[model samples]
Target chain A: MFQKTLTLVLVGVLFMGIATLTYGTFYDKGFAASVTGMMGLGDDEHGEDGDDD
Target chain B: MTKLRLPKAFELLLVWHGLLVGSYTIAYLTAEGAPVLHQFAGYSVLGLLAVRLTAALIAGVRPPWALPLPKASMWKNFGRKLAAGHFSALLGRTPFAPLSGLVILGTLVLVTLSGLAADWWEWEDLHEGLAESSLAVVLIHIAIVSFAPLLKRLNASRADAAATALPRNA
Candidate 1:
């Protein structure tokens, strides 16, 4: 059970990382901004391209 | 040599549960500063919820796809066992599991719908509120699942100790 839980956690982290990268690339945001934004700690501007809103 | 295979419904349930967990985690984590990722994860959650609800409708109240509404009889039985001093009952599946699941599902549906409406209307506050409150439901669910196994191990160790003590007493 521990192993399975660890595996799932790792997979979830990988998924989140890939999602952050993809969002960063598609929106032209840097990787650091993407990570910080996803973590809700970034001060970056949003909805500039009229897409997020 | 025969290979073991899980039932199709069970396998699908596992997959759906994993995806829902992943999507909800992403959506919740991204809700503050990451609009694009938040919307993406939130929509994934909405889509997954739709599929789950549809499957429940088609499959009826069966295992793996059943609605998480705990029946009154189940609650009554669980209460009776607890009253009878069956601490071991805590080690097994309890009605709270389904109840928590139902709560989580309801909260997620409301959150997603409010979020969808927020896209065009002034419902962002409502969406955020629902999303924030849903975290409690998720945490409760996690607690229930995590503690059950721990309780089972504790019960097993106690039983082993009791058995050993009985021999010494004899």
Candidate 2:
């Protein structure tokens, strides 16, 4: 049960990490912001390129 | 073999996101490319993040479970090791885990600050400079995120190997 819980948590991180990692390539134009909802790389400020209007 | 089944298809989606977006970001500033490519790719990446966050938020309402890790100390111990790697080990036991959590939290905070500063910083100087620095912080954060699962996988495999290596009676 514990392992399962941990695995779920890890999965969560993995997906988020994936989101953040992908956004790194193209985050400012609109794709990163629109498609990813601004998933910033660890310390990224993915605001300008995201959904503002 | 225990035959662990993971969400391979979903995981693949993540891998694609990480690779394409990550490559674009690294290549842009370093290689000098057309600005149009940056916007399209960048926003797509952000949209991916939004989707993931929505999933995580939705998952939060599910029932919780416990692990049989022999003792509570094990979870704490794992957290500590993680903290040590992030350089915030002074917080006491379960160093890396808590530190990692804090860093993730800190990343969230910095994101808010930098995002606002990107357009609305009142100070006359250092706006761009501060924004640039934030990019470094994000890069470092992503690196750490990459290290985490790999680190755990290595540890898991090592433990499995050690268990299997014990001498058996003839």
TM-score of chain B of each: 0.87, 0.41
- TM-score of model 1 (first chain only): 0.53
* Model 2 agreement with the true structure over B1-170: per-residue lDDT tens digits: 68777765345444543543353353233212323333444344444455545554565633211111123575666666666785333233333343443344344344334433544565313534543655665566455555555566777899988778865521
Q: What is each predicted model's overall lDDT from 0 to 1?
A: 0.80, 0.44
Clashes of each: 0, 40
The number of residue pairs in model 1 that clash at the backbone is 0
Q: Please, what is the TM-score per model?
A: 0.81, 0.36
Give the per-residue lDDT of model 1 (tens digit) for B43-154.
8889989999998998897887989888999889889999999877787788998899899999999999999999999898899899989999999988987788787788
Candidate 1 local lDDT, A1-53, one digit each (tens)? 53455456557556755765587667746787777866777553345546753
Please report the TM-score between candidate 2 and the true structure: 0.36
Cα RMSD (angstroms) for every candidate in the order listed: 4.6, 11.8
| Residue-level error in angstroms, candidate 2, position B149 | 8.8
